[model samples]
Target: MSPEISVSTNEHKVLGACPHDCPDTCSMVITVRDGIAVKVQGNAEHPATAGALCTKVSRYTERSYHPERMLHPLRRTGPKGSGQFEQVTWDEALSDIAARLQAIAARDPQAIQPYSYAGTMGRVQGEGMAARFFNQLGAARLDRTICASAGAEALTQTLGHKVGMRVEFFAESQLILIWGSNAIASSVHFWRHVQTAKRNGAKVICIDPRRSETAEKCHQHIALLPGTDAALALGLMHELIVNDWLDHDYIARHTLGWDALRTRALEWTPERTAEVCGITVEEVQGLARDYGQSARAGQATAIRMNYGLQRVRGGGNAVRAIACLPALVGAWRQRAGGVLLSSSGYVPVQAAALERPELLAGRTPRTINMSTIGDDLLRPASPEFGPAIEALIVYNSNPVAVAPESAKVVQGFARDDLFTVVLEHFQTDTADYADYVLPATTQLEHWDVHSSYGHTDILLNRPSIAPLGQARSNAQIFRDLAHHMGYTDPVFAESDESLCRTAFGDQVDFDLLLTRGHAPLPVPEAPFADGGFPTPSGKCEFFSARLAARGDDGLPNHVPNFEPAGADPRYPLAMISPPARNFLNSTFVNVQSLRSIEGEPLVEMHASDAAARQIADGDVVRVFNGRGTHECVARVCERARPGVVNGLGIWWRKLGRDGTNVNELTSQRLTDMGRAPTFYDCAVEVVRV
Candidate 1:
C-alpha cells in the first residue's frame, strides 16, 4: 500500500461522461492526482455532446471529493428510520445484502422490488440490467414511469408513435414554440441552438403558465393557467381551421379523425379558450397564426416542447392537446418539424431489453406505480403485502426524497416488513432509509454509454479512474449479484463487454463506438422521403382512431378528473414545483457552489402576490396544507406567476432538516396509464413563520 509506484503527471488524466440527472449526459475528462479527481473538462471528441458540459456538471470533480460523501457501506443497527448506522466492511456488506435478499426471495420473490428513476438514463446500467435481473427472478414490477410516459402515451395515442426529431432539426426549424419548457435553464446547449434558430429568422414563441427564462426570450408569451395547455392548443387549432391555415391536403392524404378533431376544436373557439386557458384572446390568436403559417417549406414547423411535465391536474390531456399541433400543420412531413417529447430514440435500451425474454417470458404478477411506491408497500392486494416487502433495491435515484409524497415513502421504510437497499456515493434521503447502503461509484469511476434525450448521438462513457474506496458500478454490482443468485444462463454469463454488445446487439459494436465517444443514427436524408408508418393505419391519424377505439375519443377530451390538487378558496394560490437549473432533484444539493448560491430553500412569489400577503423578500415563512408543513425563506420575484407560487423541489430535510422537500405537500395521486403526478397546480397557503 506504499506510494512506491510513481506515475507521470499525464498518467493521472482520466476520461468519463457526466452522470447527471439530465438528458444532455455530456462526455468529460477528469484529471486525478493520488486518489482525488482534480481538473474537470469537456472531452471535445465526444460525439453529439460537442464536448459541452453544463455549469452544474462542469464542477463534478468537486462533487466526487465532497466532504460529506459516505466512504464505506453502513449497516443500520438502530431502529429503522432512526438515521443510525455502523460502518461495515465490503464483505459483510455484500454478504449481508445477498443473504438478506435471498431470505426475502425465499419468503416471496415479489416482495423484493427494485425501485429507481431517471438518475442515469443509460441502458447498460441503472434500471436496465437491474430490471432484467429482477424480471427473471419473478419480482414485483416497479412501474416508475412517473416522468415521461404520460406524454409518450398521449403522443402514441394521437401520433401512433412516440419519437422526437433529431437535435440538428432545430437548425432547420422556421418556427419554435417552447411550451411549458425552460430550455435555457434545463438545457443550455439546446437553448444555444434556439438562439441560433432565432438569428436565422425563425420566430420563437413560449407558451407557459409562468413567464419562465425561456419565455423571456420569446417573441410572445402565452401565460396560461396550469392544466389549461390543452384548451389553448385546441383553441389555436380552431383558429388555424377558421383561417384555412391548416394543411388540408396533408390531412386528407395522410391522416384520419380530422372531422372529430375539427368538431372538438370548434367547441374551443377563442372566447372559450380565453376562459379555460386563462390567456388573453389576442395573444392566443397571434400565437396560433405565427406557428400555423410558417414560411418554412419543410413538411413540419419545428416545435420543441417539453410535453406535459408542467401539468398539475388533467396532465394526460395536456400532453394529448399539445402533441396534436404538429399533425394539424403536417409538421412531421418537414425536416425541422415534429413534437419532441423525448429525443432519446424509440425502443430505448436497444434490442437487448426487447430480445431478452428470460425475465418476462412467463406471466408476471401485479404492477405498482412508481409515484405510488408507498401504497404498493402498504396496501398490496397480495395476502402478505404488508409483511412481504423485506428487501428493496434502489439504484440511480433518491426516491425517499424525490418521489411525490416522499414522507410516506420514509414511513413505509419505517415498517420492519420493508427492507431498503440503496446504491449511491452519499447517504441520500433514500439511502438513510436503507438496511444496507451499497457503495455505488460515481461516473468518474466507471464506464458506460450515454443515450441523450436532447440529441441523437450515442455517447461513449470512459472510466476516468479506479473506483474510489470499495465502491463499484451498478452494473458490476448487478453482475456480481446475479452470480451470487446462481443464474448460470448464457445471458447472465455475459461480461461487461459482452453484455454491452448484447445491450447494443448487432446495432453497433460498443467498444469501437466508445472510442469516438458516440455514434449517431442516420435520419432520413430528407424528411418523409417515402410513405411509411408504424401503425395498422398506414398514415398519421389527425384524429386517432386507436384513441377513439380505446375510448379516449382522440380530440383531447376535456374532462375534470379526481386530482390531489383541489383548491381551498382559503388558500387562493396554487403551488408549482418547477425544475431548478442549479440542481437536479436532490443530487447536487450537497455540492458547495450550487447549493451555496441557491442559499436556503425559498418560496418565490410574484411581487404583486407578495405585496397582497404583506410578505417581503428574505422573510422566513411557513407553507402548509392538510398534508404537511414546510418553512423556508421567501423571495419576492416576478418569476412566479401572479396567482401561482414556485418552490424548488427536494432541497433535503437534513440540509434545513425542517422538511425542505416539496413532496411533503405533493400528493401521490397519478394518471391511470402513465402514473405521472399533476404536480404543478397543488393548492397551498403561506404565512410568516
Candidate 2:
C-alpha cells in the first residue's frame, strides 16, 4: 500500500491547480523535487486539457504525503462534536478563533456565517480573504444552493446564461444525451470526449435509474424512474412534438415561448410519458427518436453535461429540462453541437468565462441553504429559527459526508450549539465536526488556482510539497484572516498573479493562460449572429418570462417529482448514492491509490433483491429510516435495479455519531432551484444485521 514516489526530470516542473470538485481543471505539472510535490502531469498546453489527465488527477502526488494529511491548528480538547483535537498553535489557533469571533462580532453583524463549498472549486478559491472575512463579519450568507444551485438556477432562469457547452465540440457529436449524469463515475475527462464521440460515429444515450458505468459503456441505456427525469424529459418533448420533429425554423426563428412550448408539450404523450416514466413505451419512443434525430445530420449533438442532474427534485426544472436539448435540436448551431455546461467555459482564446458575483463589488450576502446548513444549525433551539450558529467558518468544505441531512449534519456539528471551523485535507466528514481544525494544502501542497468541470482549463497550482503541516494556502488562510481582522480594501489587493489577471476578465490575451497552460475558447465559426438568443425575449426561451415571475410552468419544464421515499410499507426499495471513490467529496478517502478503488460502505443490491433479503456478499446491512440508520456492507447485485439501494457517496462515519451516515437517510427534500436530494427517491428496507 505504498506506491506514489516518483519525482525525476531534474524536478522543478511546478505548475498547479487541481484544487478538486473537478471538471477537468487538469492543467497541472507539479514535479517539485526537493521542496516536494514529486510527480504530476497533464498540461500539454492546457486549452481544456490537451495533455489529458485522469485516474483521480495523475494521483495528485499521493495527496502530498497523505498519512491522513491534516497537519496543524487542531484545538478542540474533546467536546464540540468530539473528534477530539488538541494540536493548536497558529498563535493558539488564531487566538481561539479570534476570541470567539470578536464576541460574535461584538454581538450581531448577522452573527457570522462563513461556510463554503465545491470543497475547492477555485478562482483562487473565489478570490479568498474569505470575501474579506465575510464582509468583515457581516457574514451568514453561505448557501451554495446545496449543490449546483438547482442546475445553476435552471441555467440562470433559462439561459440568461451560466456555464455550459464548449469542451471543443466534443468530437463533432452526432447524438449524446446522458442526463442525471454519470460520465463514467463523475466526469472522467468528460468521459474522454464521450469516448471520442463514440469513436467517431457518435450516439451515446444513457439516461439513468442506475445501470451506469456510463450505462455500461453506452450504446443506448435508459433505466428511468428516480424523480422520473422530468418525466423522461417531457416525454422527449412529446416525441419532438408528435413526430413532425418540430424545429419550426428553429422554433420560429430563434425562439421565445412558442405557444407555451406547444402547450406544455401536449401533456407529454407516449402513453402519458410511459405512465409517469418508469420508462419504455419503446423506451420513450426510442429516446424521442434518438433525441430528435440529433441535429438531423446537418450538425449539433453534443450533451457532455454533469452536475449530477442538479441533485434532484425538479433540480431547476431538471436543468431547464436538460439544457433544452441544444435548443431543441439546432444543437446550438453545431461545432460538435452543444451543452458541455462548464469546464469553466474553456478559457479565453477569445473571452468570457462565468463571472457575476452579481458582478462582484460586495453586498448580496444573505445566503443559508448549504443543504439547510445542518438544519440552519439545529433549528436554533427551535424558537422557530433564530439565534445559534454562533460561529462556523469552514472552507474547502465537508458538511459531514456531503450534506443533505447527513444525520442533521451530524447533529449540527454535534451541538453544544455549534462552533466548527474545518478548512481541511482529510479527517473530513467535516473534519469530524471541528471547533477549529485548519491544516489544508494537498494537490501537491498548494499554490492553487483552478476552474473547469468538464473543460475550459484554468490551472496553476504549483506547490508540490513543503508545508505538509503548519499547512497553508486558501490564499494563505485568507491572507492571514485579512491581517487578523483589520480589513484593508482593494479587496485586500489579491495576488497569485492578480488572481490570474482576474480570471481573465474581458480577456485580450489575459496572459494567454499564463504561457498556455490551457487557453482556447472563442468557438467562432460564427458563434451566433443570426440565432441571437440571450433570453429577455432576445430568443431561445421556450417560455421563460424569467421563470414567469418564479412560479414556473414557463416552459422548459418537466415534472414527475418523486423523492418522498418514506411511506415505509416496510421500505419498498429506492436509494442510489453515486459519486464513487475517484474521491472528490472525501478527499480520496485517505488516499492509498484511491482507497483501493473504493472500499467500505457497500450496500448496492439487486441479485434478485439480494436473494429476497437473505442478503450475503459481505452482509451487515441496515439502511433504516425515520431519519437515520447506517451499518453498510451488503453489495449484492444484478447491476442494480430490482428494489434498489446503493452507496458510494462521501462515507466518513467512523463509529456511531448518530450512526451510519447517509445523511441520516437524506431527503431534506429541496430543488426548485436549490438542489440537494441526490437523485433516486429515498425509501429503504434491506436488512441483514
Candidate 3:
C-alpha cells in the first residue's frame, strides 16, 4: 500500500520494511522530520506485525544516526585485524576493489568468493544485483547454509517444500508444540499468536534443551538433551501407534512408506527414548498423550519449529521426524493444525529472473559451503580444492564472530595475501580485517522488497531519506563495481526499484506492494488438507525415495550427535550457543543501548555444573573443548539444564573476555543431510578463570 503520508510542512511518514535477518519482516513506518528519520514503528494495519516491533528494531533510528555509523569508504592503513583505516572517496575504493577482483578473475574467477547471508532479507539488497555480479564473474558458488539449510532440505524431502500452515492459524490451535524454538526471543510475532491460543485455553509445550523464556511460560517444558529431538519424536509416534490414536485413513491415503516408518518408530519405546534424550519416560509418554488426545478429540494441534534444534549432526532427520506428526493425526484437515518451520515456499520468487544466472554462460563453478568456512578458507589450492580463495567480498554477514571454530576463521581472515572488501554499516569483526570498507545505506534510505519465512506477506520498503553522507545501497555499489570492471550488461544498469519489481515477476502484485506497503499471497488456509502435498506423489513421504536414490536411509531415524553428552569424560558437558535475547546474530551487538541491555557475554550453567567447577554467578569461566576456548561470565541458573550450558552468544569477538565467542569451541563438521555446520553438537569442559 502506498504510504499514508500526511505531509505537514517538512515532516512525513514513509512506509518501509525491517531489513534484518529475522522471521518477522515487519512493515515499518519511518517518521521523517526535515529529511531526517526520527522514528520507526510497526505498521498497525499489517495483520502479522499487529503494530508491534521488537526492541532491537524499534530503536533503528538510533542505529542509523549513531556516531559510529559508517558514512564513507575506507582503505586499510594498518595491519589486517588492527581496525585501522583512512577515509577514501567512493571512486577510489570501487576502482581499487574492481581492479583487484579483475586481476583475480583473470587467473580464475572461481578464486573470488562472495560471502553473504541474510544481512538484509530484501531481494534487491540481499542478492539481486550482487548475485548478478558474481554470476558474471563466475565466482565460486557459496552454499549459504549457515542457517536453516538442514531443516529446509528436510521439509523438501518430506513435504516437497518449505511450505506450512499459516502463521495466523496458530492463534486458534488447541494444542501447540513449541519445538526447538524460543519464540519470545527470536519470533516475537509468532509468540503473539501462541499467546492468543493460550488465552483461549490451549495447551502449549516447549521442547528444548534449555529452559528458554518461552518454555518458562508454556504449560510444560521438556528439557531433552540437545540433538535427541528425533528420538523424542519417534517416542511420540510409538505412543500414538500403541494407543491407536492415529487417523488410519489419513495415514493410508495422504502418506507414503508408513509401514517402514511405523516399524522404526515402534522400536523407540518411551524407555529407550528417555535414555537417549536424557529425559524421563513419563515426560515422553505424557507429551505423546497430550498430542494424541488433542488430535483424537478433533481439536487443532500445531507445531512451531525454529532453527535452534537443527544445528546438530542429525538435524535433518529430526526435522523429518517431527514434520511427520501432523499427517499421522490428520491435523492438516484443520486450518489451525499442522506444523511450520518456514513459509518461504508459499511465495513464488523469481530468483532466476532477478539474479540473471544465465550470465554465467553455462559454466559450473565449484561450490563452497559457508558453514565450513573455518576449514575451507585455510584449504590450499589443489585439483580437488580448485583454487585457494584469493578475494572475498563480505556483505550482510559477520563470519569472524558467528561462524564455527572462530580461531581458524580468524587465521583465515588474517591472511595478508587475501584481498578482502566489506560492505557494511559499521566496523564489524569481519570488517576489521578488510582491505577496503564501503558504507552501505540503511533500510530507511533504500528501496527494496522482502519475502518472509514467518508469514505470507510481501513487504515493500521505500526510501524515507536520501543516502546518508557518502553511503550507497548494496545494489548501487555492485552496479558501480560492474561499471569499473567494464561489464556491459543492461541488467547491471537496472535501478533498485526496477529490481524490486522483477523479484517476483507476475507472481506477486508489485502495484499492490507499492500502494499498500504489504500484500498477501493467495495461499489456501489449509494447504495440505486434501492430501495434495507438493511431493512427487502428491502426499507426505514417510520414507523419502530421494534420499534412497542418494544412498541414504529412506526412513527417518535418530542419529546421535558427533559429540553426544557423556560421550567423552574429558569434555562431559554439552553446550548450545543460542542468540542473546537483545541481539540477532552479531547485528545489534554493536548498538550501545542493546549492548547495555545484554551487558556482557555470559554462559548459563546449572548450579551443579558450576559447583563442580568451583564457579559462582558472575565469575569469569573458560569454556574449552578440542577446538578452542572462550571466556565469559558464568550465570548459575535453572535456564541451563543439567549437563548442559547455554552460552548466550553472537557477541562481537573483541567484546568477549578472551577476544573470542562460543563459536571458538564449535566445529566445522557438517550435518547428516545438509552440508551445514554443527554449531550445537559440541562437548566442553568449564573452569573458573
Best by lDDT: 3
TM-score rank, highest first? 3, 1, 2
In the range 1-689, model 2's lDDT, one tens digit per residue, is 00123446545665565666766666666666657655688766555565667777787667667677778888677765557887867877876677777777777545567777776776665534566556555666765766566666676565565655666567667688777677666666677777887888887888777787778888878876566676677777878877766556776787677676667877888887786766669988887887776566565666665666566666577667667756766777766676755534334421122222322346444557777776777765334444567778778777677777677777777777567677877776667668888886655654445656565445555445667768886767766765666655555556545655565565535455545544445545424325664557666676677666867667766554554333357777778777674767665666766766776667688788788778888888888766767777887765577655776666566633334656677767776655555544577787888
Q: Which scores better on lDDT, 1 or 2?
A: 1
Q: By lDDT, is 1 or 3 better?
A: 3
Model 2: what TM-score? 0.34
Clashes of each: 7, 20, 5
Task: Please report, in order, the local distance difference test score of every candidate based on alpha carbons.
Answer: 0.70, 0.66, 0.94
What is the per-residue lDDT of model 1 for residues 419-500, given as tens digits with 9 covering 90 to 100?
Answer: 7888888877777778888887777777666667776666656666677777887877777777777776656655554555
How high is the lDDT of residue 436 in model 2?
A: 82
Error of 1 at 518 (Å): 0.6
RMSD of 3: 0.8
lDDT score, candidate 1, position 38? 74
- Per-residue lDDT value at 312 in model 3: 96
Against the true structure, what is each candidate's TM-score? 0.93, 0.34, 0.99
